[model samples]
Target: MLETHGLTANYGQFRALFGVDITVAAGECVAIIGANGAGKSTLMRSIAGVIRNAAAMVVHRGEPIGALSSAEIMKRGIAMVPEGRRLFASLTVEENLLIGGQARKAPGPWSLDAVYQLFPVLRERRKSPGTALSGGQQQMVAIGRALMSNPELLLCDEISLGLAPVVIRDIYAALPKIREGGAAIVVVEQDIGKALAVADRVYCMMEGRVTLVSKAAEVTRRQIHAAYFGEAA
Candidate 1:
């Protein structure tokens, strides 16, 4: 459903991605695992159009979307949860979700009620400020907010970064239902076990390039460690 070919990204002269290639087939769940400064988030940002790249960089369902704006990409069915769960602190929980549908409003399997069902606590905290929620609840709100867009591909960057183990499990437990709803997923995570547990395939990056791509079930822990740290196993 999504592919990046020779995707390179730069912030001024400091390039973050170096000819990175990635693919996520329809209905597939892929995870990107790498250490700090490995450019995992850079790839996600490029695909989401938050970081512009060359016209040939990112392709979605066979069409090029490298130069499109973030809003344009979201309208085209690519929604991102972002690295830090960047929710609008001023917006109420319900209001934040309501805004997520403002891009196109194309009818799909997701809506306010369905999102609340995915994270029932969100329903109870509907009127609370986004910042008032705990980190786990805030992450749920971020995921629910993305689902509100009813996207075909959901890009989750560092979804479990700072959450507790139980909270991470709770967050991941929502993936099956999300996949059942037919959204292709690409998750960028530092947690190897979590990535392996939920991803159908995994890609490991080092210094802005993909060094390893394998079936999650087939890739060994040592292999992941090597790719993550740029060391020989």
Candidate 2:
């Protein structure tokens, strides 16, 4: 339900994305995989409105929302779990999630209890400071906070960046439930296998360009290797 057409982004004079084109259909999960400096996060930010662009660059459903402020974007039903799991250090886990619900009161199935059910540990840690939780727990809070918004489209940037494998598996296990709620998801992940496992389609990028786009089940390791690093596999 989201599309990026000839999207480009810049930080001052340094360009981060170059005519990047991608699309996410309703209720589907899409993965973007690339190494550091590959602009995956930039693409996510551009769509999330952290980096603005031409009016037609980013579209949702059928509307052009390229220049909307982040708050406006959220109100329109897109919520982002930023790359760093940027939780409010002062707020408790429950309070942090409450902020998300307050931001966008859209009607959906993602309530506080629903989020807790998706990540049970979050309920147990509800009274703890958001940042005081373990890395994986913190990540759950970030995701829960975004879900609390009851968004139509969710942009998750690096949700598995630095967690243990078991924890990562637990985190990824929640994707199906999310999609079952009828929200499309765009995940920016470095773990190619993990991304492929959860996504229906995948985009591989390198040096600010999309090198390959294919169905997750059909894209081969060799293709991903070449697309990711610009080298023969």
Candidate 3:
């Protein structure tokens, strides 16, 4: 449902992505895996409209949206859970979630109660400051906040960045339920195992270019290792 064609990005002439092409089909889960500085997050930001590019660079369901603002993109049924889980420090857990929906009031299955159902602990601590939550709980709130927008495409950047294995597992375990709602997901992750485990297709990037693209079930660890390090097997 989303695709990028020759998408390039730069930070004041220091290019971060090089002619990167990728796609995520409706209701499918795609994983982007790479080492630090490999441009995974850059690609995500570009697609989500955080970094502006040529009008034809990014496409959603056949229309180019690369030039749209991030807020406009969210209104167009795409929401991003940024790398840092950048929740509003002053807002309570419930308030943070509430604001996410206020931006784009599209109708979907996600609601205050529905998000609470997805992460039960969020319901219990609805009135607590969002920053006061534990790391895993904070991550849950981030995900919940994104879902509040009822987006058709969800961009998750580094959802497992600093959490424990069990916590990561807990976060991933929510994917099936999320998918059941019919939203396509793009996960930018550093945890190879977790990425491969939940992805239908995988793309490995290195030094701002796509080095490998394969079906998750068909890709071998050796292939991932080779692509991740830019080496030939």
Candidate 4:
């Protein structure tokens, strides 16, 4: 489980988040949704430890980890599939996946072969340069790379961004399996439908603050529109 309390972030002099608070229970899938610049990515980066915050801001299993380094965070059983799927262009798919396990090999159900099972095409393209793969395939590689760490908490930032609907569906389909494997997921996504469909709870953010938090299945479009855009749809 993870929690962020009064979490704030800044870009030089520009503040990006304002006292944001949220939580994810063990094995639950939580989604953060908002328009561009709504601080969704910022929130993810903060949680992933890419951007340092007050030591008490981000807590994992009741431990204060907001100020931990990204690598430290990874070693603590939290892995991030960053926005843009920053795969190594020079590394082969298998090599990229291997790099994930190199940091910390925490015991879990994810392995090279298990990841391949989650996304079968990855096994077929194991030796191909990561960038040589199609967008959807590349995304799969990104997810596979994170899973290779066998993290307890996985932070996915925009996994569906820029992919075709079918391709996005393929990627989203792996969420339940990942959950079944016992990892809690916090997905930062723009596709409202996909986010709500996969998440148990959804947080709608606007201008760097949380405007709505609801059970995903029960959320209405009008509420999301209002919370996301600050007005009625």
Q: What TM-score, computed on C-alpha atoms, does each candidate reach?
A: 0.97, 0.98, 0.98, 0.98
Off by over 4 Å in 1: none
Give every collision pair in model 3. Answer: none
User: Candidate 3: lDDT of 195?
Assistant: 91
Give the alpha carbon lDDT tens digit for every residue of 35-142 in model 3: 999999999899888999997999998999999999999999999999999999999999999988987888999999999999999999999999999999999999
lDDT of 3: 0.94
User: lDDT for every model?
Assistant: 0.92, 0.94, 0.94, 0.94
> What is the overall TM-score of model 2 with all chains considered together?
0.98
The residue ranges of model 4 lying beyond 4 angstroms of the native Cα positions read none
Can you write out model 4's per-residue Cα lDDT over 155-187, one digit (the tens) per residue? 999999899999998999999999999999999
Weakest 10 consecutive residues of candidate 3 by summed lDDT: 98-107
Q: Give one clash count per candidate, in the order shown.
A: 0, 1, 0, 0
Give the TM-score (vs. native) of candidate 3.
0.98
- Summarize candidate 2's per-residue lDDT along 1-233 as a digit string, tens digits: 89999999999999999999999998999999999999999999999999989989999989999999999999999999998899999999999999999988778999999999999999999999999999999999999999999999999999999999999999999999999998899999988989999999999999999999999999999999999889875
